[model samples]
Target: MYESVLVATDGSDSADRAVDAALDLASVFDATLYAVSVVDTRRYGDSALSGTEDIVSDLETQANELLDAVEKRADGGVMTELRHGKPHAEISDYATAIDADLLVLGNRGRESGEVIGSTAERIVRFVDRPVLTI
Candidate 1:
């Protein structure tokens, strides 16, 4: 019954699986697919003026390329997005902004009741939409 599905990918194998799952769900529901890749801006120091632009540009290019590849593999009704920010915050905001029916993501080896990584756990906590972790 999903109308719009958002899948966040990091070009990892787990994320690839999540993409496949989202694609299958989209196909079944006749839903539109939105693929997002977030470039973590925290990796760069705020005061580092030298080479920061080039580094950020390269990261953006890489993120775009990854999203493009995923979109190519998806069916016709797919859109790609590349964002720069904390991964969880950006993804959650995007889902809300786009009124997504569901947000899909891949678990990066986190166990139940244990501390999940900040990104994945925060996403689960912050996003109002249902999250399907593959």
Candidate 2:
């Protein structure tokens, strides 16, 4: 029943699972699949330090690679986005902006336990769309 599906990835194993699941779901429904990797800007302080640029650049590069992997795995069937800001906030805002019919994400991202990643939890509780966490 979905027309557009969004999946947020962090290059984690769980996120990889979510990507596969999202792809399958999108294929089943003939829906558009969107893959997003957010660069958590909060990791950096309010002011830019000497090496802050390097860190952000590295994060952005990582995010690009992650999105690249998702697109590759999807065989160019998915649209990818690289965002900057809080993971939950950016992902949630993107889903809303895309008017996604469904949101798929890993239960746990790179930084959280196996139960539920903070980003995933926040999106589930705050986003208006249906969320499926793997």
Q: Give Cα-based local distance difference scores for all models.
A: 0.82, 0.90
Ten residues in sequence with the least summed lDDT for candidate 1? 108-117
Q: Could you tell me every candidate's TM-score relative to the true structure?
A: 0.88, 0.94
Candidate 1 ranges beyond 4 A from true positions:
49-51, 109-116
Off by over 4 Å in 2: 48-51
Candidate 2 C-alpha lDDT tens digits along 23-92: 9999999999999999887776657634578888898999999999989888999989999889899999
Tens-place lDDT per residue, model 1, 22-110, is 99989899998999999887767656635568888888888988888887888456888888878888999889888999988877522
How far residue 98's Cα lies from its native spot in candidate 2, in Å, is: 0.8
- Worst window of 10 by summed lDDT in candidate 2: 43-52
- Whose TM-score is greatest here? 2
